[model samples]
Target: MNKYFNIAIVTALSVAITSFKGNAMSDLSQYVDPFIGVDGGGNVFPGPCVPFGMVKVGPDCGGKDWNAGWDRDGNIHGFSNVHVSGTGGGCKYGNVLFAPITGNLDMQDYSSPRNNEHVALGLYEVDLKRYGTSARLTALQRSAMHEYTFPASDDSKIIIDLGSFLSSHERQYLVGSEVRIISDKEIEGYTRVRGGWNIGEPYTVYFYAVFDTPSDDCGTWKSHRVEPGKREQYDTSEPTGAYFSYRTSDKQKVTVKVGISYLSTGKARMNLSEMNSWNFDEVRAACVSRWNEILNKIEVKGSDEQKKIFYTALYHSYLQPVDKTGENSKWISDEPYYDDYYCIWDTFRATHPLFTLLTPSKQVDMLRSLLDIYRYEGYAPDARSGDDNGRVQGGSNVDILFTDAYVKGLKGIDYELALEAMIKNAEVSPGDDERKEGRGGISDYNEKGFVSTKFERAGTRTMEYANCDYAIATLARGLKEKEIAQKYMERSRNWQNLWNPDVESLGFKGFVWPRYSDGSWWSENDYSVFQGGTWPDFVYETFSWELSFYVPHDVNALIEKCGGKEQFTRRLDTYFSHEKWDQRWYMGLFQISNEPGFLTPTLYNYVGRPDKTAEVVRKTLKERYNTTKEGIPGNDDSGSMSSWYVFHALGFYPNTGQDLYLISSPTFEEAVIHLENGRDLSIKAKKASDKNIYVQSVKLNGEPLDACSFKHTDIANGGTLEFVMGSKPSKWGTVGVENQL
Candidate 1:
């Protein structure tokens, strides 16, 4: 764990009903790391936007290469309120942050040489000659919490420059508010924009802004400032900067709050009213309250620091997929319908599943949105629902996710409609050439059936099979198509093709058999091999070592093939005790850094050596997920990685995305989940941690728990789990793999 970052307790438990933040903590605005989404990498943007929001506050430092927020060389561009770092589409709104020393507005006083502009927690200081101001910014969510001790100058005030709206969805109307005493906060107005691939309905946004100190031109209405030669049509006054009166003082303290909503101005006003003034104490209290309450939903008991890491990461995981459409269900993207976030094609995997635990309403809306996409576009959203679908991030992901949710009991989606979408999706693979009766793509179903990775294609293997099974199984279960389900079940076993019989491992040599056109083949070689450098030690010419252990549905099959339980036990030992191969591919070998490998921990159950699984679970949870830039190994793919940590920490993982959680190793000694239903799943782990990875014994509901698969039924009913843990595996739970088979 890096000492630079501290793990602080969340403080309270209150949902943000009236306001985004309830009580103890600050507003969602406070905890948001604007820089998180910076092109620093991936879709990460280091802007002022709330997590995953389009309203990013950073510099105009020219695209990504020039850098943002900080980079103040002559490369130093002006600041903008809305921008995306590592992403698509043009920028929308940009409200520049500046300290004005009463002047004719200067734009080029900054330097060609980048200098001190280091941003961090509670601090955002910079030396800028451009605006003839040395500025610093800070925040606590509801309140901007700024103490910008600008250099002593003549009459001056920080400018809330509405240079541009991040795609016109931004509304900047000047309103009069006397801070704590004012009633109306926003300038009764809104801006409109469209989103999504085919261009769905446009959205109108209303926003209310609050300032800490009383302003001179309080009530007078001001129009939005537009730059010359601008094309978008709008009724607005030319100048965009909002001016307030104040004399430059040493370390002057000021606060600001921005309330945004897709509803009418009334709703936006309500948001401001609910969160009045820039009261740090009040807002922080509210946010903290909401956090604590939701956090308590799954109460975690462990070292304060570890708890912080878990909660913080968990917090980040749920930051987006926000309730943007409002209660009535209407939303617009900067790019309009063509890029509406409502589409489920992308979120199903990492996004939707994580939300299933806390934000079901949002999940409902998402499903409805997918339904809308199909109704309007004549197609259920798949991999790339935008300008092109062939842009394969893998389309089957959505189908698999739909099946996962349907089986898990989410209501709202039309069964028939869902079936049609799912079946149509399955019948067609993303890139297939030949078509069949049921299959949607060009290739016949046989060629794509579960087979060797060389045949099915590695990246396309797991999900294709998963979705095929999903289509058949969902059809069977929803309408009793058992034979179809059986067919898919057989198809799902295609993962077996990747399993090499001779080497007794997942893939021995031609793991690269199906190879690709880029010559990149099946394995990763160098650091830049994959995006984000393979998420920790995920880099594998073949597969991350930890990932190779995955075979969730048929661990016993793997165990039997590896030789009996004792021999399988030896192989397991070899896995846990092995070192990196020194080759570029085997770097860090722990597959925990990858996705397909996520289910590896639960594999121990099929083999009968549950304790081994538990020990590794404990170790990985401790070592791999430390709080640092390197904290999580992979794309976070949304929250899959964190969810993995949370579940494993609690002692089990779902074997299927459905109502079946297989008991696995746990980290926390005592973890309790306060389900929304008033039921509580309490886990008591005695002697658990880095040293105590093995379980000496286990007891669920006080019964002699012999085997290791815990059902969702047992957990949802809410009960106690007690595991006597130690550093060494207990012989009692050491059932060999081969014998079980």
Candidate 2:
């Protein structure tokens, strides 16, 4: 039972446990609940996407709201082909919408009441109330297949609206657009959207749409006029496009296969080659198979709800750093091209490491993609979408992501080129042309040893820069570049510059505070009430108090600086105790809601007390997550929060920029991590249950593994890690492990 229990039995059991209405070969994809993050601030797009595929075809709510597409209460406004899952603010990329109707053009607002929806890994369907039509959808790598069932009527029509965007931000970004009917069954177009995080860079997405059956009467339209026999349409007054009216029987299905590309309309046509046929059922089945193949990488044997939560998180995890390199890639290289990196600031903590564990091959391609971006654009992108860089969030943190991949020994990337990009990004400041590219305050950080309060997000920036420097140094050491390693390793300690040792409040000394360029502490105001609003003098999205514990690469050094183990323990206790655990405000103090405070709960493992870590981890698991529509605590942040849950549930967490995993009490009795290297790492907990949440002892390969942690290499090599569970905290993992870092 310690091993993977044979593939035949697993397959047989999987087939037995699932029975769906459609022709789905595997049932694993069914466990993924698309609604998990819809209500929560998870902000995830519950759409049809094949793994990291670009085209996320799903419905957008009518009107304008922050939830982008498909808010729980908002009316359904048809399906669109592009979206950013789990992000903050009003971002771009919900282009080219197609809505089906069966009535006269009396009401243009097809904001129908949604009902009887079926959402799977790569499938979505919802009944539109007013028209009594059902919209079923699926997708390929870069294409969307929509099958809209209409009632018996002569006015049955398919509307291709180019200006139907997800939010007002996307609409504002629309510079220009063009649509043309190629033939009776074919149409081609492009939309150019700028700003909305892309600044002045306009993103032109080309599309090729083909209908299965030709319409009886087809014509193009712009603004409010229905242009009969007009073959072409350009930018008009308001949200413009065309409509195809058809005489139909009851339950008539109008199918359309649409392909999108950032390169050209030809590339979009090339992408549509994956469809091969107009069989909607076949496409949906194929999508289900592909999703199952990816989701079954990690198999768990838990309750139905647990499996739902686990698979939903797993689904969210693969939503991005989308694979832009396909058969019809925009770039002229064999190396993989990945785009829509919402921001490494959110994902560098856990999401990237989750990829290392489950999809190392993809991780390699992602690293190569970053390097490729550097090769073409002259600087690595921060929050990129639709083939353009967005606004820079924090420090140049792609260095940390690259470093994480390199240390984990993921292959296929050019290390020399990666090292060059990392060093260049760290040392050089971006020119005016590339404002959101390389490190911004590098000059001040290098000279003054800290970004002053004068700079935006000064405290968080200093800590993030230090972490990035540490990662670069680690990569340099791996490549045997001794000089580069030494240079960056020294610079990595610059986080110490922000420590305000004189602040002794609430029995806790040595708080990290903001400082002036003249080396004086900017400690005149209160930081606990949150900054950057009326004050306009604080870090980004977080308080300095929360940002203080962010020294991930060198927590031991942080512990020593904060007056050793006793005082450090007191501060950690105070941080957690000060705030009441609310899922909404996971941003407040030990904010598990976001990335800034991810490593706080596990800090106890470093201070020779794994029991406290166990307590907090269990409490968070119990309180924070569920199987509700609003399951996730906050913004999934492109799966960062979901990945955080996945790792913690499986009983380990990757220390960012390092190869080590800090172990804790796992939620499941047994979990088999199917490694991409053709191996399986099984974790079995004896007497595991809700009550038995404390680890009594741990054994790696039947040996007493006294260390409360293990290296990434240990799991990759394959073995069983058995943890004995108890109802109460014991002496297990209390003393600590030497040289673990």
Candidate 3:
């Protein structure tokens, strides 16, 4: 960034920070702004969506029929259903149709700014300044508590529209309504929405409504087709538009109890039966209890701000990876019935990995969910996946996850069942993952073989042979998968074929010498490798460099290719120094921001430069992670990025699928990890601060030790790693696996 940009960001952030000094305590909800980046970056909606649920139940951003929460002038807009307030990609979600607007169920009423544009977690209340009315609603997972305060005119009516969900309109409308009045205070109705992707079959949903105390009401049900062109005809809004409503009486202060059902209208009525009275205390208590149970997983006794960020972040991490609250396994995949909200590529790395730690049991259940998806459709669930058939987007990260889990020793629920899922993921033939959309051609060497990028023809070959390569090698060498392992291990070394000498590493290069791979030349025509470049044209989302030479299985071979330990160490030094490296591209060690580069910080030990590993770990933690908005250095692929922080901060990394990590460095004076299993792991480093960056010596349980990393087994067995600090690096540790290439 330039000096001017830096100065402005600091000035803006400084003012914001100075004003947030009131309460600095941890309670999960306080630290969350939910609006910080929701304005423009990616209309990622920030709402009360629970961990693992499919629906993104939050404040509607990207506006609905011109209604948005954040105005360019920083004013708040109306709170609509199906909100993706703010996220990276600029996209919108379901609106109107099913969104029943109470008082003035007309989109034009919310065309301009009004006073009632505000939101709250667990509860959201906003006023329609123009209409002189207000609406407030809270939820308890399945049920909602609503209170709308409006003008005393008897013409006011609460619209009950079963077809509204964000932006579904006009020609796309397909709703089957069966409305019935149960009592003056209650009504049960069903709205079946028929649409797919953009327009498909009608999916059914039921609504159960209950009024506060009682009300004089006889109801008639009607279906309305949306006019997609209603894109803010209020003379102010444009393509930014979406809204829906059902008109009903507008009594002064009316209370409502609304319940939605996916089964039938009768089911929605049953929901009303289960929740009759307007029990504010009961609803609030119920919501709190659910949050407490999920939040209690990894408790932090830190400052208020830390707790908020931690828990809320933990909240973000847990959201959308699995089906925490669903029917059947309480989680369902699209392949079974074809649905929305499945970004497997984005969630696989960190999200699923993090889920393993928070809900271990859920892992098997998730696997079963995948298996069930397979049973239903012959393939594991891809994004809108068809189990074993059809091409999907990106690599099979689930494959690597399977191995990583087994190696980490996280097992139980159903080992056999889990293995079945793993086998299917590996064996599922590759067709088109990482299509690169309209782009084409080959990527750099590092881009090939990566599970996600089967974009180009060769890219597919690289992925096709990668897992069998790892599983085979790991089976024979690491996991002891002798017979079947060797076949796969040999294939795993395919990464070596793409290796070249010019840039000194593996790159995606076509044979014929004139072409290249990893460090070689890449065809600009190959858009498949555009995002994550193969060897020569390495292009990675976090950066091409990180992924360019990421071959975790062959560090020793890399040493030989680079010349020797000294040359290899010199390269390591370049990554940390962050300067003075010859380059055409320099995106911070390239893929340092993604999972491919996660293991990079620990490779120093393999080249006899343990001190470098320590330095990177320290710098990375302080630079990338903090108590601020920009704290997340990269897309938090679930928890892998954060999990990377957790593991590295403690001073080591899981090096290979061995699940064992080499101790490189420490970031704290003292830290303790209370394991889910009875035992606790403690880590302490002395003289470990800004200037004191080297490990003078390390001791395990007071006994002097060698090397910078430790094995997971050793820690799991219950032990501590103590370190002595110094201004210079120490090289007396184990001769170790100096060059496993």
Q: Tell me how many clashing residue pairs each candidate has.
A: 79, 1, 109
Q: Candidate 1 or 2, higher TM-score?
A: 2
Error of 3 at 101 (Å): 5.7
| lDDT per model vs. reference | 0.45, 0.78, 0.46
Taking all chains together, each candidate's TM-score versus the true structure is 0.68, 0.93, 0.70
RMSD of 2: 4.8
Better of 1 and 3 by lDDT: 3
Order of candidate numbers by TM-score, starting with the best: 2, 3, 1
Q: Which lDDT tens digits does candidate 1 get at residues 51-94? A: 33323344444333322233223344444433323322222223
Tell me how far the alpha carbon of residue 700 in candidate 3 is from the true structure, in angstroms, after superposition: 5.4
Which clashing pairs does model 2 show? Answer: 586-591
Q: In model 1, which runs have C-alpha deviations exceeding 4 angstroms?
A: 1-152, 155-255, 261-274, 327-392, 410-415, 429-447, 450-458, 461-464, 471-475, 496-512, 515-551, 554-588, 732-741
Q: Count steric clashes of candidate 3.
A: 109
Instruction: Report the alpha-carbon TM-score of model 2 versus the true structure.
Output: 0.93
Tell me the tens digit of each residue's lDDT in model 2 across 1-741: 011223543453455333222333346765888878876677788878888878889988864644447777778877889887888666567789888987765436767888887676666888898898889888988999999888999889888878666565534456777788898889988877776644537777789999988988777766657787797887643445777888889998889999998888889999899888686656766666667766777877788888888888988988887888853234587778898888787888889899998888888888888888889877777667767676566778888888888778788888888889888888787866433678767777989989886676677778888988988899999999999999999989999998888876667677678788899986546454234321134576666667788888888888898788888887788777675445355522566776778888788888878888888888888778888877888888888888999999898898867878998779889988877777789999888888998899999877998878878877776799999999998888876634322
What local lDDT does model 3 show for residue 520? 45
